[model samples]
Target: MTPYAKIRVVDASTGRGIPLVELRTVNGIRHVTDSRGLVAFHEPGLMDREVFFHLKSPGYEREADGFGYRGVALTPRAGQEARVEMTRVNLAERLCRLTGQGIYRDTLLLGEAAPIPNPVLNGGVMGQDTAQAEIYRGKMMWFWGDTDRTSFPLGNFHTTGAIATLPKGGADQGIEFRYFTKPDGFVRAMIESKESLPIWVSGMAVLGKGSNESLYAYYAQVRSLSEIASSGYLKWNDAAERFDIAQTFAKDRGWRFLDGHTVQHEGYILGNDPPNVRVRADAESLLKAEAYEAYTCLDEKGEVRRIDGKPDYRWQKSLPPISSTIEARLVREGKLRAEETHFLPLDTEGKAVEIHNGSVHWNASRKRWIGIFGRKGGKDSALGEIVYAEADAPTGPFLYAVKVCDHPKYTFYNPVHHAFLDKGSTIYFEGTYTAEFSGNEDKTPLYNYNQLLYKLDLNDPRLAHAKT
Candidate 1:
């Protein structure tokens, strides 16, 4: 049915397909691998001729030949098969893109087998940002930040969402999403707004159980890049198929409110990294700011209590916990010592690691609460690096961390570990990958601003530092 040839890219060590591997001909014709690490290449006049392709992928490399070229010369034939092996140098195995078009585009074009019902495009969504998921109404619902479309660059910024049947197999297998679409087939804004500014949502979760349950989240209206104009709580309106504002918070009242991906621990909803901020998992309590508590080190009047230059930690209401960023600042200011901090995570090299955004979950296999987050300032690729750390308790002295994934020149930020996808020692996490903060101009087609899911094994020898 087609003149395309199948070129499969796989990890040399595991022999599994390597997604996002790029191959380009001398003429600059580019082909990128799909979720299965397969590329369907069909170039006019290049078929059946010997063509040399330069291979490039993040954290992957091929041995150079005597000519010092890290490429291969292969004779392309219609419907024929080829294979290229790349060695993975990163700790976490980069899997596939979860948002945007062309997820399985190449695979579907060649009439070959591919995952997902809609392979080329779904719900007219070309690109989307950091997605948050929740188990609601018998299915998993996804809410993302801003989205881009095929029609134009200035797309929906009012928040978009989708629902999908949770996949049964491991995360190594591909996953699919069916968006909540409008009449025009574009993904409709999940959170409606009268204002012209954009809105983003997080901390989405279901409160109560069974027939009395209701879904809720925290929404922020953005005027510029990330400056929040106003923030409030939202409740799902099943009749309208979108979120409705539950209550609005005054200035500075948003901090103690629920934020980030939350987890239910002992009948309470835990929010943010280290699981410090929490509230009772009930409708009435979650809506009340006085009901929320944070594992903080401040006095009742909101003043820091220091004993011998170290903070005194306790669970307090109406006050959010001190962050690693604050710890770093306090350490630099002689108010706190690096050796005695409770919240700051240190790398295996014994240096303080700044966490930009991440998720913390209780891992059953590791039996330790693990934090997987994006390293804020890294020499490797700015926000592209991911690090993993563990604590005996959710409130960490998550002291030692290991660099789990690395992107030399690309930015992959806001990593979240999917507790629902845990398969013993094998864990899955995803983040928004983009060129926005990396200072890189060349963005990978169909991948920029989409979530890239990664798999990390706790049993891997490289993760030994995080064991204890």
Candidate 2:
């Protein structure tokens, strides 16, 4: 008797049809499911023998089974299709590390495995932290906090500010070092002249619409290490070859700025009057002592209005307002205790888990807000465990988080999501990987004090049903 089979592939959790799933039979016949996840095939002289099927997809886990097993056997009736439910792969497995010239470069200009015995000049923008990546003008642009490696061997010696651009394709295509603050002749001159100004430019936020966009970089203005650290804001002047100081905090105010850390300028802008910007602020002594507070800003008249209705040119004068809505939801969902003063998600032990320099962005494919943050685990665990969380809205009731990547005995911080570089099912993010602050000096070769990329799939069931 002639044998024939019809198969329908679907997600195990959502039960939605998974398109383009490939299935191969033991007899060397291959069939790919269509948009509806249905595939049919026929073969003669196969009724007497047992048949097995192998399945494969990008976001779904692969499955293979031999004949005679009740669940694995393929015995489809004449007009009926056999349903094949494929489990979604975990987000961790889908993350692929990319290859590039690590954060530092030598005089020889070697690749990832270059030696650091005798470093003549600060090569390839030096080691950096808090990498902020964006896809601009058809290329990937990366801006990071350039550490002063000459000052100390430990991490984040001092931020000098760095920028690099990568060509199309992926990491294999290589990147071009565009700018470094310390190496730039003008910035070096300022530092050498003993000027009491900001030497490092970091915490960059790209603002404005297409063609009219501007890059706003943040700096801490200090004559000496002991002086009150103030938010020294700078705007990149393309016509001129330097970043000009846009705003500086008054010394008498005694305010320190913390979280202009990461900015989401796409839809958070409110009104047409120069557009109000939303900033995240962490409580220090300068502010009202509330942790992880959010503030609204208006950039039109060169003044930022705090939630208290006080306007000031300097960003520090504007105090971060409490986001009661998000705090209430988190408490209701048990993600935060009612007594906790911070807005970050709490661990099982009720400790306020710091996000450090995590990023939040919208996942268009999944129609949800996704975030990746550095989870501050206890001393015994890896300090660089990257956790993934999702929410219905940007300012969220982000209730649950799952650990996606665990680098035991190492330190990974400042996780940034590259939402513009996403390709439908697959999304990318990165962080500064090092052992400098982990208390254990053991470091991974070719990855110490450098940026590491992580790729996640939107179809992962763990992220899809994260709240559960």
Candidate 3:
């Protein structure tokens, strides 16, 4: 039994009691708030619990307990009063697939890299000789485990396999196929195999860069062309393990699929045809505002403009694409220097740039930054050498960052997350280690055993760091 609080939940709109409402918590406990909108619990175990409210009367819809609701921190004290209200819920308007806590799918697959001391190397499971991968659709996000080529005849028994996790709380592991193709937005992986066996491949989206310490995956299952008509949505789970909420939310209402390229939904398709906002940084607050002198080194070598003839200057609002002429006014007598734009490039166009999480500050040590790049070729993961860049600030106006890993014919290396240890000036980046799959490896096709994390000395000079 639970003790009830003598509280009243009056309707905000009608000012009437919302009688007999049941409240539930995330931990599977339920209590009822009375006609006056007051519900009480005897125990306060976890402060992190989220509560939900439901009414037993008609015309009243479910509600959630918000910050306004109060609970004792584990004492016999006056708890906070909870208010309840009802709103109409349209069955057709489901929660967004990307929103909420839900499971999408799960899959079983093996992960491996070359056995060499370095994760990147040729003639191994993943062919890339460097730690990098490119951003291309139809590329495999992860690969199945493969045999150790060194073990020869015995290695024959150890084959490779792949798996994909669907969005609806289910997984397809150990797919029985040799070649797999994913048509954007079709929701299913098309399989080409050695035998006519029913093969299934799990589908998942990688949430962040390929080199992040770990890939956060949302598993999704296939929705055949037939199922699309009845189920107005397609979905993937949070962890690619279980189906919890509708993944498509509302996007599926107007959905279409292209043979090889786009997944059309809500009048939009996925591609890089033109200039759009590809990447954005977190909003940053301005520290201060000021103005600085402008210059022109042309034949005259003089000021660009003058306020009143005395070396005119103005306070400026500086952001990315710092090569523009946007200036601010100096309200005070302080010298205003332009804030240097700090950003990382997304592609060759350099249109979409994001801020780099600064490097670790070393208390006592010299350091360098190594850049490795690669691309997927045919079936192998071909890679370039490790480039180098050095800067006092991890966020840089880097004089020279190595493009040692640049291979025009190969895909550019996709660097995930990087961490610099200020204590030792050591830097580490993790990502999938892949190269062109030569097709000579047994059992597994192209993407067999394709994940690896690379570590390097940030202060190493052989691989020169970018000069400031």
Candidate 4:
């Protein structure tokens, strides 16, 4: 039996394996590095022949050869190994796949020891979507929408939950997940659905004192990808270790959903993507929709009024904060000018970096609010660009937004900055890396629609762009 040549791609400086590097043969045979940054090559016709391979990876670079081609010439031999090194160009360094199978597939295939104890499959889960997390019950409680199972095409759609010990390694070391699974071994629904529509959970947070601490999240029942039929809130049942519907809100309930990172400031939880809407940190205020207040410029009647063509940014009650969607509509309606917008941070190009979705947290090191957000309607690939920005306060004037991580032809969206995992100036974040919104149809094997973790140093000179 002939073993295929094992090709490995690693970071030139660290000599650590890099994931998602694309290598293409001169004739167009394409290969991507797996979680452990490996590709097992076995092209019989090209095995003996010296082939020119093109290297293409986002946030990484290799020098061009004499003919201006940035590729390597390799003569792959059976039962052998080859190595390629690339310099990480982006401030953010992609660590590994947080969800999905074959995390260390090729590394394991070569009989190498994996980083995590259970590298192949942790929860018997194939893949999972956007992660909503909170530090709860002395552990990191995580919930995700629409999980994929190894056994079938369909999977747990209501919600999937997992719990892990609070990360102490700043996420450079891969964190482990112990999934909430059913008897059949697939991830069980955090909350079972009684309707035909699927339930996707988000806005997870923990409330109350020590023994009285409780977990909660906002759930939306969807008729399709864009159409959410109904929305509601849920509470975690400590005894059953799952979520139960606490209150079902009407579909017209204005964007009072605590949708992203919830930061406690001045005894109130500032739920920020907008950071404008918030409720008192107490258990009772969080459950009541009317109790939440919006930091809006609107009058009591919920009307957008401009003073001398400028938005009067102020705190108003019972009104929704100007979200990205609302900002876009107001701009089109000539109610809000581009220059007066508050939430859309700007890149170095002086272009307003339209943000799709993201989370913000107060970083103690910087003493400023930091955000990791996905770009929207930019020249870059759709849903593939990520930007980092900071503000003096959680709600006002994000100085600048700069590119931190990028996926050339892939979609990496809904980036969640894990403030709980932050160590000094080093920040850890993760996002849903998928092919769904991306025009490319080639789903990354064992990795698509899953979370990919990345880390960045706030002191890095490259990030100085955003700081300015």
Candidate 5:
């Protein structure tokens, strides 16, 4: 009967009705016209774009434009319906539509323009059927959620640190400059060392649920007690299957440790080979699987360190070489999914947005939310505030974290985006810090942005806490 909607068509030569002729897209969609040569398809969303539709039948040279085609483009900030027309194809034509493309920079309204969707109600419930662990007074929620069916937003925080890798011999475990993630989604992780001034950063999805749990982190600015004060980029190529933080300059840098040295290390023995073992396995497997390989490493090691013997590899040029580290993982409940490379290729916009802070401490006593701190000006200033939304279930239409607020500072950095609170739970908050009136760079942005992290005080009417 009727497959979709209806449109009109006319014969070019006879200027008469081309009744009964089949209409569809060249990609093999079929539709039938009525007595007036009119037919329709079932679809929407088209504006300022072009499209192609085809006409089909048992063999006459098909005409594409004879039936007249139409197109529509995409709106930068809104969604709209795209009306189109189909033309006959002499050589098998089809209907097509175009979409608008460009960079969109605007102040996203809290309840209206929030970028991330609420996972709890959006069917993004992760870790539903897997083992879940709550640590630090529910500050850290761990579960397995299915991201494939859910919508998750990502964030990028820049920082640096060191990653130690254990080689074939346990004697050598060296550390490199890198970055990682904080439990609270900060891109800064301290190594608890005064002699080494390195920081860890992360770039990954801030909010996710179900089996789709994933994060990307890195350690960087790795240096000795003396040379630690410098702003340089460190590029690391994971293609070498390198893992564990080892000292390439030390005598035993390349060696692995077979026995335990520290009390914490006493338990993990044979089970632990070296940091790079798994990475090497992965690199080899990938090399054997794919016809091509891609990896990069910066000369930022201070001293170029190369392991001897058939280290089992080849070398490739390091693009944007910096002492950057990537930590990627898929947590399947308590079980960890295979660790994949963390550094993702730049997007069409050429901006690295998501980051991870693997070592960030979550002080629930301090606040239920985490604050994302960034410089006031420069490219980072473009970072908007975080927002959170909530709904009753995984299929809910979510509401904003802040019901109403127009203040320039607090509202600017207000928590408005959603992040995974746990496997099945999530919270929404905002980033972006306001400069202090005192003009004190560090202290101002610190207090302004850092203090943004706070629990939804039930008594606080300013926040969009659970109603009723």
Candidate 6:
């Protein structure tokens, strides 16, 4: 009878399968595990012979036996499966590879080893609000706030709104700046009496609609110093193959603002139906220190219903009147509370950790809601750490934020998760890496005022055992 064995490789700590692990037998035959971390071998002639298996993978350390040899010697049993566990080299390793210089277009223009260093889009500006979507087939579009160079070294610059595209499906490839709203562009074309110019499209949600599957983008506009302005939509024109503000939509009922008060509509959109698409807006009272969020529904008639059921439209020239608001009804039914929508998470010290800009996504594999947010303050002060928290629900009492990445003297803000770009147990996220808000007067060359990408493995023991 031939000796046969089925081998499986998995992370020792988390018990999750580790794919692409290499295994070699004493007979010099080699094999690699599949996506499920499984591989099988059978040898007829060596039925009674003892076999030894060697395991190896990049960025991982192998466990040793009493003799310090790096393999496991085992006697095969017919029709049985054996499991081998491997440990990661460093689960909390904060390492990232800088691929290109400036945006994708700049990288191509200034080939490797160009005499002069490439300048980032609109001078030395950080890429904030890293919103990503696959509008077209296999093409990834990234929208961000182009904080054009500021005259004051320590002050933040206003955004002109820029976009870049990666056609190779991965962000690792070179990027090309597709659309960059100039200082004299439409976003900056209008001037408010007491407000600043260049309203920024800070938070955006790319949605699809209709039979032809046309795409539309809903964004939260903000004035200078991050003041909430209004909410509007943009339509994708197939002829131009670009997005344009739906002027008609904006003209009719797209604007939502308040006088002497801030009511910002920021955060992701959920649900599918056009009439019932849920908008999670982070409402901050700049006058006071109070900050909370609310869930509003966008009806087919372009009416926004507040959580309390009131039509929260500011202008209604020819629009229908809001018959009744849901506020009273929801309160009477005990379905809504004014105190439950606070958006910040608490740290280990029981202190509230303010979240400036981050992403929240449902991780079905982990069966938990994962949120990646930039910490407002820590050992390195504001924007020094990227925190990770999990919860049972999207709107959560997200507690015990774990410090995943520590940027001591650097500022990393607007950490966005690209769930659409996730690869198995490993997920990718990017944030604006700059020294603008770090209190560091000096800027690091080639890395300053650009975006940095990070890879987090969900199977890591630290992340797997993350507290809810």
| Regions more than 4 Å wrong, model 6 | 1-138, 147-196, 209-211, 218-223, 226-231, 247-344, 348-351
Model 6, residue 189: displacement in angstroms?
Answer: 12
lDDT of 6 by residue, 391-429 (tens): 765545464566676566678776766776666666667
Write one digit per residue (lDDT tens) for candidate 1, span 1-468. Answer: 578888988999998888888899998898889877888888889888899999988878988999888888888777888988999988889887787899887778778766567777888888888878887867778789999999999788988988765445546665677788889999888877789899988888798777777999999898886688989899999889899999999886856777888888788888876577888889889888788887867676655687776678777775667777877787778766776666677777878887787888899898888889888787789899899988877777777788988877999887888878778998999999899988899899888888888989899998877665
RMSD of each: 2.2, 14.9, 25.4, 2.7, 24.6, 15.9
- Candidate 5 lands at a TM-score of 0.22
Q: Where is the poorest 10-residue window by lDDT in model 5? A: 96-105
Output the number of the lDDT-best candidate: 1
Cα lDDT tens digits, model 3, 1-468, are: 223222334444555444223444545465543223344444465332443333332223544347544232222223333445544221111111110011111000012121112112222222211121112233323322122332232221111232222222211111011212223211122222233222221111222233332221111222442332222112223244212222221333221210111111222221111011011110110000111111111113322334453323222222211211111112111222222222222222222222111121212345433222222221212432223444443223333433322212222233332332112554433332233332233221222233323334445453432443
Q: Name the 10 consecutive residues with the lowest summed lDDT in model 6.
A: 255-264
Residue 257 of model 4 has an lDDT of: 60
State TM-scores per candidate: 0.94, 0.55, 0.26, 0.92, 0.22, 0.50
Which candidate order results from sorting by lDDT in descending order?
1, 4, 2, 6, 3, 5
Among these predictions, the greatest TM-score belongs to 1
* Alpha-carbon shift of residue 22 in model 4 (angstroms): 2.1
Of candidates 2 and 1, the better by lDDT: 1
TM-score of model 2 vs. true structure: 0.55
Ranking by TM-score: 1, 4, 2, 6, 3, 5
Model 3 vs truth, CA RMSD: 25.4
> Residue 43 CA error for candidate 2 (Å)?
55
Error of 5 at 53 (Å): 65
Question: What tens digits encode model 4's per-residue C-alpha lDDT throughout 157-199?
Answer: 8888888653344367577888998887788888866785789
